[model samples]
Target: DSLVKQIDAEIEKYFSGENPYRFTQESRELYKSIGGTPFLDGDYTVFGEVVEGLDVLDRIAGLPTDSHDRPMQNVVILSTKLKRK
Candidate 1:
């Protein structure tokens, strides 16, 4: 979807638009190239980032999902740790 349509969707679902403080053209481009859900830009809380787990992420993403988009088997998160710079 075009950027305008994505913003329109956010407004339609949440009755408000993207957070002006957080939304930007660069972010929009990142979302587009990364297969992200742009409509979630401001409405969702970011849980965490996979600083060192691209292969694991890819493996999980490759898992088969059910009709509702849940993984067919339970995928337990083994652990999480903050990676300090």
Candidate 2:
């Protein structure tokens, strides 16, 4: 989370500049309704969604990480199944 905070600080510093990209109303509403790293709005690209096993996501998020932010335990993805509706 420290890295996220550091990135937030840098984003704040840049937000003072002219023509800074602001978070969209959709993103703002989503953040308010749920919760998220609003600072990452336009920063990262989400490739996929966890359709199930949210508990697994919570467990993974709670795991201890090293200085490089890599989880201490080796969490491997053996395979993935993508379904469309």
Candidate 3:
């Protein structure tokens, strides 16, 4: 029982934090104009942002969807190649 209690305490600590919303300063600004969800700020893993093709993403989001929000028509990705600066 003591060992189980220790493990539970650690688990709780891992999920606990002072702020429910967390983001970089740049991200915080983006939250205003572009947008963001403060409620889910720290709950997700943000790898990268779409620096390009934002218009395409907007178009896809505007596509028609069903009751479940799945697009009624399949949106095909033509290509994705990384451009080195």
Candidate 4:
């Protein structure tokens, strides 16, 4: 939840700035108008990077990207199991 808290703090900062209207629902509407897609990209301690099936992710990333660079289809993770270290 740290990431969520971080993003919330940033949103609050934006709302408190001089251009207060920038934080309105219309701002989100403007993003939708431009077809914006937000995503997280990075390594986090709580959820480590995939140790296997990385090639699959690469393939997915290589697929023809949309205007927002997201793959056309959704990729589902069937299951995951933790192994003894």
Error of 4 at 74 (Å): 1.5
- CA lDDT of every candidate: 0.77, 0.80, 0.80, 0.66
Model 2 lDDT per residue over 1-85, tens place: 9999999987787765644546789967988898876556668987788899889889988999997578998998788889886
Off by over 4 Å in 4: 1-46
Which numbered prediction scores highest in TM-score against the true structure? 1
TM-score, every prediction: 0.52, 0.46, 0.43, 0.40
Q: Choose 1 or 2, whichever is better by TM-score.
A: 1
Candidate 2 ranges beyond 4 A from true positions: 1-32, 67-69
- Ranking the candidates on lDDT from highest down gives 2, 3, 1, 4
The digit string of per-residue lDDT tens for model 4 on 3-50 reads: 999999878876665443334688587767875433221332344546
Ranking by TM-score: 1, 2, 3, 4
| Candidates' RMSD to native | 9.3, 8.6, 7.7, 12.6
Clashes of each: 0, 0, 0, 0
State in Å the error of residue 15, model 3: 26
